[model samples]
Target: MEKKKLITDDGIRYDGRKLDELRPIKFQIGTLKNADGSAYVEWGRTKILVGVFGPRESHPKHLALADRCYIRARYHMAPFSVEERKSPAPSRREIELSKVMREALEPAIFAEFFPRTTIDIFAEVLQADGSTRCAAISAASLALTDAGVPMRDLVSSMAVAKVEGKLVLDVIDQEDKQGDSDMPMAIMPSKNVITLIQMDGLLTHEEFIQSVELAKKGCMEVYAKQKEALEEHFKKTMDREEV
Candidate 1:
């Protein structure tokens, strides 16, 4: 079988987006009534929902920390999320992503304020197009805020990739599978702090620098949308209360 050309001479990708262009993104806050806080996100064809429950007491006493609340995170994908049905069992990638999600979000929240408790983040990917981890972190941050978790700042994340020798932003599944590199990053937008960053594949020093700059630009766009969605969510809530 012949390989598909990922990029054209005019810098258009196979999906008809230019290099550095992101897939369509949408966010909805407080999607679940039972959860303390919740959010749903759609990036391109990828969809993920995150729910936050607690600063409640830790179930196992030994798991509680005297100084700060423990962060318990889980990342799971539905069996029918991808074209090929995923196994219901948690895979190694899911376990790793869960840990990564925790770390990415921990720096934003003031865990010390709620001692001997646990803040649970449940992220479910209903579909997987690409950059699911980045979308998960973005949605999880909003869920934290919706749960009334006080935080120093919110995290926004995005991915950068190199396909057919052209660097692109907001990588999709096709690009990631065939591309030369994939770098996912999370940052506290207001504080200018990087909470999580990981790169796979190869890049030169120059390309790495360029990719970081590009990723930062993409993350800022995500951050702006996140804030806009939150503002809209709160506005609707207030309007409903007034009615």
Candidate 2:
């Protein structure tokens, strides 16, 4: 197969992006009122919403330490998110993805500050074309910030994939299905520290390097959006106070 061939021989990929381009993103913080913090983000066709609850009171059977807050995350897809309706039950895939997302977010958050409490991150996928896991992580990060949770740095995530023997940034749904491999990564941009990384399929060392580079480029874009959203949130709050 020609690998779905969204791009043509003239050097254009599907959606008219260059090999290393990512989708445009729109993000905002404080979308929810009751939650401590919340954010919403949309990357191309992928839409995700995240809500944060507490740094307060760990539930029964605190298997983790009480000296620091526990980080819990849930990843869910709505029935109408995809072309086909999804099952309501929480499947293994969602559980695993949730775990990775939690890890990616924990380091950036000052979880120890809330000792004996729990921080719950809930992510809902309203529409998913590709890179939903990355979207979830990004959204959760923003929601934490919106919730006024202290953190060392902002975390952003992106995905890179191999298509037709070439590396591409921010794979779309169709590309994901047809691509040879996919790698999703979360990073703390200022520190250049990688928080979470996952990959599927195979790649040579050279390909891996190219994919990581492309993913970093995409992540930088995501970070920019994250900052913009936070600034907007604060600006609105300041405006409200003034009024």
Candidate 3:
């Protein structure tokens, strides 16, 4: 991989990181009182909040299954999340993202343990500077864990982009739009399994494989942080109970 510039002669991509570097991520679990679980994640300028509810009765008709709980995810971008205000309605893009998010999370969660029930995950983008979808999935997993939902492994995610013909680990908004390729992947690291993947733009087969490898590497870092957050959340809960 060759490193080049997205802006400035310094050869730094946007957000001032070298290629193969991820944006700084900050996450917190158990942030909501109403939902069974909730979490917040911030990467670069992108911020997302996720709420997990259920393993409860399924409403409506035809959607419910007797064998296992339904996994539903909603990914929404707030009007103020972008530079221009976006519509409040769940557009086609939002719906598609939601569907993809659900698939990413389903394998990690033990949905079969809650037959005839439903698990609903709602992710809202508070600010988007790209990589919001990846962040959303990561946040949703944390929220599910906070809800005490049984999961095979914590799902962690990261993105890689081709900037100036060089593969970069994470792309901010400007670099993403200008980049030649963007690949996002979510993984159950302990299981060594990929739960979700998405690609846009173009890449050779070799580039694609390399991108996947790099994304997995980034996700491992994310997984460690997520685990730490979970530990801290439980510690706080235990302390509060004791007090």
For 81-127, candidate 2 gives per-residue lDDT tens digits of: 98989886888989999899999998999888888788899999999
The CA lDDT of each predicted structure is 0.95, 0.88, 0.87
What does candidate 3's lDDT look like per residue over 1-243, in tens digits?
465457556557666786777778889987788999999998878999999998778886577998889988999999999988899999999999999899998898888898888889999999999888789988899999989999999999899988777788866887787789898899999999999999999999999999999999999988988988888878954654553
Q: Give the total clashing residue pairs for model 3.
A: 0
Top TM-score prediction, candidate number: 1
Q: After superposition, which runs of candidate 2 have C-alpha atoms over 4 Å from their true positions?
A: 1-3, 61-64, 239-243
Model 2 lDDT, full chain set: 0.88
Clashing pairs in 3: none
Q: Pick the candidate with the highest lDDT.
A: 1
Q: Which stretches of model 3 miss by more than 4 angstroms?
A: 1-11, 238-243
- Which consecutive 10 residues in model 2 have the weakest lDDT in total? 234-243
C-alpha RMSD for every candidate: 2.3, 2.6, 3.7
TM-score: model 1 vs. ground truth:
0.97
lDDT of 2 at 31: 86
- Judged by TM-score relative to the true structure, which candidate is superior, 2 or 3? 2
